[model samples]
Target: MRRILALLLLAALGALAVWLYPLARPLARYGALPKGLDRPLNLLVLGVSPEYSGYHKRAPERFRGLTDTLLLVRLDPGANRVVVVSIPRDVWVNLPGHGWHKINAANPLGGPELSVRAVEALTGVRVDGYVMVSLEALRRAVDALGGVRLCVERPMHYTDRAAGLRIDLEPGCQRLDGAQAEAYLRFRKDALGDIGRIQRQQAFFQALKEQILSPWGLLRLPQAVAQAEPYVRTDLDRETIGRVLGFALKRPALVSLLLPGRFGNGWAVDQALWEEARRVYFEGQEVAPASSLGRVVAVVYGPGEEERAQEAARRLRAMGFRVLFRPVDQTPGRTEVLENGPGLLARDLAEALGVPYRVSGEAVLGADLTLRLGGDGRGL
Candidate 1:
């Protein structure tokens, strides 16, 4: 009886260690991060398209294809936020040893290492690791999670017999299965073209993040990761991945930004905008308080929040901001500040309001920044 009790106690202690590992690892490596900044883990994610004739065909041993999607994700453990910057595949770049070509071509020309180098050159940001995943991996992961719920902003219909791709979805909020999710992601036939597709990808990512953070999603994560593992190639070790996921489970703030550029011969980089993004989002620089004065601010409040919105506007006016009020049809779950231009105004407003901020593609009321008052802003 004494021996059995001792063994049982040992097993319990081992389980506790396993459960605590993710949280402890990041703390141990805190000193390794750069000085004057939160330790941000930057990951370059490449989504490889199918090269074979069939969509379901097995992937080649070496991932060779023009990347379908490219993203530079920053996981800032200190700030408790995840920032994602989407790079358009069509952006023209001079690949080393290969003449000028689309940024996506970097992957097929050399692989992830070359791709990482090209990205580092383009963004001037150091990438700690890379994750290359096939589209089928996304499908399997979604299916393993049962499915993800997303809102379809408009009716979408596209079909391609050659690639075995089809997308037919109506405008509304609904749950999407594996195949449907893949189709939703791959469809780029609309007027906005690749840019529109990028928007959808961002929305999908936001929804997927929410789903993953849910209690059910956490319980099923192991199965999802297992199903998708075969199609993923990554340099990150399991322990490092665990630390990132563990940080994510704490419900960090999420901010999404698109690589600033305009389409011409190829996507032309907007130098000024890129610089701003590099400083604030990539480098994690804090916005100066003095820059907040005289900025145009728009407050879009949810239904029945007019009083709170007015009070918020009064506070903003007192801060030397010109305020505009707009009423939104639906209520948001949390407060958010949207930046319309390359400035750090949104970051300042978000910081002032104690909420999260994201870069917006469109401007609201021609304001420098827009404040979205949600249920969580009742105190304001």
Candidate 2:
């Protein structure tokens, strides 16, 4: 009887291995970074809305509307860095087979393919793949992750009864639910208009990244992906997606930048800075030290931080930068460096000052870089 039982147990184990082989085969095949991703990979990501008529009614076919948010994300496995550049929707670009129009019109004109072409033409960056996600996907993903926490810079109040959109958020840091997150991302009624919306989007993404890197977020990631998958459209295969997610789990460096441009009739692209951005960001070229030496640096201080700001200005001046002082009414919680141009000088300055930096158009007017002294500046 003992001999018979031993044989039966061995048979059962063999059968289980056979059953699991198919499931585990792919994992073994993609155990390392895929060949396609050995070098830098660029992906065009679009947040698409559906066409809507009055009374918040969607068209029967659910035609793709304007791309509200456009991002060119580069994943560099060699450097272990993810660079995200946000392109303003209102930026003028010439669409293939169509005349000059806002960049957002590409999606509605054709689809992700045309949008990809438009972006490639504008930035001269080859897109390896495209990910088009609907607003519903964003809501579901955020809800699955138990919402994301973000700091609201100011009170936001807006309502569009026709589109069934309403935003009423007070100034504070708080966790936002699915509906609230959508509202926060879509609100553009502030003085900065689309530019302010872009800034808020960047902030939202930073918050989302933080949430995803947390232990709790990891635990819920599979569920979030499953819930949002149906609403997302991507050209990437499952194997590639798996590899990308695995890479993200390693916690690579994240850098965010806005497309270098100035706002006028439409966002006018600064050709020279744009080229510099392409080289430095997409091509992985280093910024020449001489190129950054002539930049005008503005040291903006909050209440009671004048001395620290002056000291910072002096340090910058010593480093061959032209420095100026500016004061603001708002008190920031932490030090922040903002770059008005396309270069990485803000990042270099942030590293030198041991603070954080962001590429923003909201920097002090006529200044190439602005360093805002916050409560944390007291230590300087």
Top-scoring candidate (TM-score): 2
Window of ten residues with lowest summed lDDT in model 1: 29-38
Model 2: lDDT equals 0.78
lDDT of candidate 2 over 64-162, digit per residue (tens): 789979999999887788888889999988887998999999998988899999999988899999988888888988998999988666778999877
Alpha-carbon lDDT of model 1: 0.77
Candidate 1 residue lDDT tens string, 269-344 = 7778777767877776754544777888888776588998899899999989999997755555457788735446
The runs of at least 3 residues in candidate 2 whose Cα sits more than 4 Å from the true structure, single-residue gaps closed, are 1-36, 58-63, 291-294, 298-330, 340-344, 358-366, 375-378
lDDT of every model, 2 decimals? 0.77, 0.78
- lDDT of candidate 1 at residue 60, scale 0 to 100: 68
Q: State every prediction's TM-score relative to the real structure.
A: 0.73, 0.81
The best candidate in terms of lDDT: 2
